[model samples]
Target: MTSRAVPPATAAVPVQDASLGAAVRLVRVSKTFPIAEGRALTAVDAVDLELAPGSLTALVGPSGSGKSTLLHLVGAIERADSGSLTVDGLDLVTANRRALTGYRRGVGFVFQRFHLLPALTALDNVLAPVLPDRRPGFDRVERARELFDAVGLAGREAALPSRLSGGQQQRVAIARALINRPRLLLADEPTGNLDSRTGRDVLDLLLDLRTRHPMTVVLSTHDPAIADMADHKVTLLDGRLASSSAPSAD
Candidate 1:
């Protein structure tokens, strides 16, 4: 395992023409979890949201405000108990398990903790998504190297998670999320584990990557300053939407 020096910032390459990204629509979506003693707890309650394609939306709320649950519903990790949940015209609630599994592959998820396999090198970690089932016409290794370069780990391909700093680990995680070229990226508290400066750097990296990848990014965060950077803002309270702001014109 090796480490690489941070390269100087370079001009962003020309935006590649790719999929227009996925539009997310939720109509009265509700999700509940079974609790002990024959009881249930509502994680999301009749939440309605419309996220534009290729836009960045911030999910703002405190802990247990349904942010994570809402992301899970969109990612198809969890099903909605009632109401419609659709992404790019596919009905998530009615989709079968197989279909949902396929759907999950196309959607990328980033977590607060950098969930890298400590044993695998950075490049190998990025390649994990495609290892199970290779996609036709996709050069897995080539793509992995390209992503390493894109994420500023160009020379650190063999570096292990234990060798990288927090920021670098998160960058690797971001690269992993983009391995499939997903049209939608779901991030839950992406910056929560890093210090303020590093968190901002990670957030900026996400924004920059969105421009190049043409993907709609939805991230949940507790920091108001971080939320302010998004194109659109959605605030949740007690499993319900408290307010949703229109995308800023700027």
Candidate 2:
């Protein structure tokens, strides 16, 4: 796999049970995507990962490696073919759909594409979690503003996605992901589309937020440069653990 240099220094920087704790643990996990002719595409292969509470880890790999697949497994977006996957105390491999749904709320996710609603103002997007269904008499606007402030998006709260810069839009996405105050945050190629400087800023923001509100952060990236910020980094090659080690703090 290719390892690209990170642009430069940025700065830096789970949901478990209240009692039966453990951010996440994957034991002998593997995932196989079915294909035609009784074949399968193995995306993740017997990967074992352990996440301690509030620790930040990054899964780095070239395309087609199992980083995203592993994230999906950890996020309960996909199931492992055979292995034990546990978050907090609920075993995902054996969790019922209802249990999994409840588990997911605490595991926030940010995608490569800014998934913000184009029509909704930035504030509304961030306020989604505290809507009426989740909490009665919830001040969605005020809460959204607070989050926007946290993410350094204070003024743009009233703006729509089409009016924001790439970096600004991403920051909004991050805020929205945090509306639920998740215990675990999963980000997939979060900086892929941004300029180097913007990417650096966003990364720095992530580290800063960890200090403010600690949580388990697992980010997936193919860019080695961006992966430099992670203290615990893993490399996946062809759906397997090629080299997992600590990234140099430069």
List TM-scores for all candidates, in order: 0.90, 0.86
Q: Flag regions of model 2 displaced more than 4 Å.
A: 1-22, 131-138, 246-250
Clash list (residue pairs), candidate 2: 6-225, 14-183
Question: Tens digits of per-residue lDDT for model 1 on 202-246?
Answer: 999998887788899999998888999998999999899999998
Model 1, residue 26: what's the lDDT?
A: 96
lDDT by candidate, in order shown: 0.90, 0.82
- Candidate 1: where is the Cα deviation over 4 Å? 1-18, 131-137
| CA lDDT, candidate 1, residue 164 | 98
Q: After superposition, how far is residue 151 of candidate 1 from its true place, in Å?
A: 1.3
Best by lDDT: 1
lDDT tens readout by residue for model 2, 42-104: 999888877777667889878999888898888899878898998877899989999988888
